[model samples]
Target chain A: MRASRPGMSRALVRRETIAGYLFLLPSLFFFLVFVIYPMFMCIYTSFFDSNMGKDAVDMFIGLGNYKELFQDKIFLGALKNTAIIVLVSVPTVCAFSLWVSSAIYNMKPVFTSAFRCIFYLPVVTGSVAVTVVWKWMYNNYYGIFNYLGKSVGLIDSNINWLGDPKYALWCIILILFTTSVGQPIVLYVSALGNVDQTLVEAAEVDGATKTQVFWKIKWAQIMPTTLYILIITTINSFQCFALIQLLTSGGPSHSTDTVMYYIYYTAFKLYRYGYGNAMGVVLMVIIAILSAIQYKLGQTDS
Target chain B: MTTKKSALYKIIAFVLVLILALLFTFPLYWILTGSFKTQKEINSTSPAWWPSEWTMKNYENLMGKMKAPLWEVSVPFSQYFTEDGTATVVSAGPQVPGAIRWMLNTIWMAVAAMLLTCLTSALAGYALAKKRFIGRTLIFTLIVCAMALPKQVILIPLIREMSSLKLYNTISAVIYPIVGWPFGVFLIKQFAEGIPGEIIEAARIDGAGEVKTFTTVAYPMIKPGVGALAIFTFINSWNDYFMQLIMLSSTKNLTISLGIAKMQAENSTDYGLIMAGAAFAAVPIITVFLIFQKYFTKGITMGAVKG
Candidate 1:
């Protein structure tokens, strides 16, 4: 643990390097084999026209998949749907969790944890389980939504919630919102707890209103947490696959098609490996850009 | 005057959150209740909020659909010893429901993932935190960047790689990718950084080797972080539907979540049967989350701090 002299010792450096790599070997093996290797292949395979099964050839078709991706209406539609999901879910998840956290963060510890667990139930309940139950609730014939809507005179007839394009995407969004709030709520609660209490007390002593104190003092302190929440929520919403695949299968005229679901459908169902890889590359780039922008904004605000 | 108004606002907020909590919990409530409803009750257009006729018919039907051996064990490299070079399989007892088999497979996958990830991440994280070695900064940066990438971005290539390794459609394929992810390594590194340098130096001064020092001193200090990572990985791998769906296709290899999804797809209109499947997939994992809620929360907050 001694500090290095002006002239370093080469043998000590060699010993440290060997020891470090020895410890890193097992984890590095898996990381290199699974993560780094696949990342290279994902980018490499995007230029070829590959398919599943042995007889199918991976023909070199430079820029062909990307060119088609731009012109394909279905791909464009899927992109737009993904955008809608990200836009709708990210802001609402942040705002809703912030509100819920502020309301419960100062309560009794038992009450606070209870509310947190309750909000997190849907997430803890696996997505396939949540989606199937929701599909039943949205059923055309026996759904509770239809029954309650008719009973309250909200609609004259039963609505085909998942079968109609108009309601299908919205239904998907509602389910996504439920599964999306758990971690953000947890983050916000801890962030709010870490806010400077003396500043809030000083503002209160000067007769600042509750709303004023929240915005002026607590808001600035939690901006970084908010930014983290925003990015994770955005990434999660963008990767909303299980719900769509389980509930709608991007059906009812492909109204609920998303980039993640489309990538799965193309790669597995249609066997268009190259095309799917191209979509994946685009999705990754978009997420990287969005996260960068959020990071930058969060820094400026703080 | 201000105190009274603030008190009123607080009351209103409490009421609103209570209502929202009820709404949030309603889906799970519906699932639990609906699983017990009779076919006649479930199909009623009027919708019974509470089941007038509770029955085990749905579960009975589910169990009757498919059956697997009660238990099976296959030894690694058994194929090489066989006359025909085929793997040897050992079975125990009578046949049980496929749901039981899926549950067993899921538990095994989650546990294996947890153990492997914890062991490897602890070793790597300790090294990254304590060792001043060449390329340490680059490796740490790579792990962080890889953690940020959405998992699906690697799915297509992963399938191909699995096939090349002759591991396609196996439980190990799914488990490996889950463990291979770098988030655990990063999380454990954050925890390891808290270990005082003097302790490590003392261990070395006492003639302890690197492995002994890590095992005796470092592991005890970071045990809580490892606990958090274990439960976190378990729940996530159990619920990782996209990976499970892509990597496993055979009925015998399927996880409970995939089993439920398949059932729902086939029996689209049979709400009673599907709810039974959903309940089966959800209950055990939710129980695990409740038991380890504290560690799980810590893992999440820690990840976010670096993220």
Candidate 2:
């Protein structure tokens, strides 16, 4: 492009740009096929009365699926179940992680690293493996929990934790809660690391109690991380499926169903593509609204 | 001045954390010992905290079964026929060989997906951060929005499309969707934003092409972020269960996570065997993170630097 003559130099520049586009092509292709295209297809298919068995889509039935979703008892139950799980699990994990993070932060460096690795071990553990281990632990007979309960005199006899509807949701929630503590803890630790040491030292010099120093200084500094963890955890709980599907399959009368699990069954097992798409659209909306609120809240905290 | 009081508080905090840390570590400890104990030992009247008899029988049996050729042997127990005409088979437990195959499949898929995600994210992130190109803000915004879109919402259509393209039940089905991931791109973009523009301009002025400048000057600067993205992507891919289960239906095609789920559905009460499989499966990921714990921690902190 250094040539004063425009034609050949312009062609060379155009060729370079084309090469840049080529470098971008593979990434763009996958994103379009997998993410963007699928999203639009999901929205578009929600308008049609389609089932998976048939190759061709049925007649367009705009808003029918959405209308039916309102009346679908299972769908409603799933939404309620998801809400309960998110409400219960996210705060529990966040609080627990924050507590542990502060604890780790206060520890000596070598011990802190050791404790961090131990805590983060679960996050690195494959979900299936953890679920299986937990499932075995939750067994009525030959299970560690029941065995422990009997040994501790907590119960006279074994209780089927996974089979009982009343306790099944709790089982799944506890598994999720325990396994997810690592992420928020990591975030909190990083957040705690960034707290201004001088401010904390000044507070200490001012004769403020440790609790006051933590509450007034360290906690406020970690607000942004807290907000991030809250939003991500909420999103995660709403979409919690793999463990539930493997452990319960929304079982003992759908007491443990989350909205994401419902959508999975609807599309894959029930073959109700249209209905599944509708539920997905609703989920997307909820996630978007919640996440946007969190973003705003995060900015304000910053 | 108040060192004594602070020391007391520190002691309390230490004790509190030590308790929580042990609680956090209990599951892993259980699995570790449970794996070493025999089925009878595991199911005793009073469960042993440590294995009374640390036998290699389970591992030997599992490894022997896994070494079977063709990777599938008709679920072994049923096929172990008596010398007589009668087939005296009872339970068809999980094929250890099959589980090993599945784990390998998961590892390969995760590795491929991790490489693709890191490469694409780094380049795209570099472009977004360093380039003053047209539509830059729009691309960055799109990636941020993508980070918020749950995979569940997009999974159905993605699967349908995969089946149509004949990618179902293959590793490609799991790996392709994760390539060029927007979340990692967003993460890397944030990290790359800290790269001083002068470095790139200086390299370019010194006769380096744009690609040269990116690889030589820009890439090394964002090494920590790239490392973070790789660890994150690998962990996420390794632990992913939904996509693996939905995409790969056959036992032979299962991942470690899916294999564990299958074991759960089938075995139900074999705590020793289940724990054995779990410990074996989880060890690889944990070992990887531990070996690279420093990098993993640094990478994680860098990724969360913005959030």
TM-score per candidate: 0.96, 0.89
Q: How much is the lDDT of residue B203 in candidate 2?
A: 86
Model 2 segments beyond 4 Å from truth? A1-23, A54-56, B1-5, B43-46, B60-96
CA RMSD per model (angstroms):
2.1, 7.0
Question: Once model 2 is optimally superposed onto the true structure by TM-score, how far is the C-alpha of residue B130 displaced, in angstroms?
Answer: 2.0
Best by TM-score: 1
lDDT of 1 by residue, A1-302 (tens): 33232455888778788999999999999998999899888988899999977788899999999999999888999999999999999999899999999999998999898998999889989999999999889988999999999999999999999989989999999999999999999999989999999999999999998899999999999888999899889989999999999888889777899999999989999999999999998888988889889989889888
Screening candidate 1 with a backbone cut-off below 3 angstroms (N, C-alpha, C), the clashing residue pairs are none
In angstroms, give how far residue B258 of model 2 lies from its true place.
Answer: 1.3
Native contacts retained per candidate?
A: 0.78, 0.54
Cα miss at B297, model 1 (Å)?
Answer: 2.4
Please write out the lDDT profile of model 2 over residues B1-307, one tens digit for every residue: 5788777877898888888778777878888888889889867756778998897766554454333122432323332344432234444444457667877788899999999988887787776666543455666677677778887677788878876666677677899888845777777778888999788768867999877887899899878788888988888889878888778876667787777666656766667767777887989889998899988887777676653
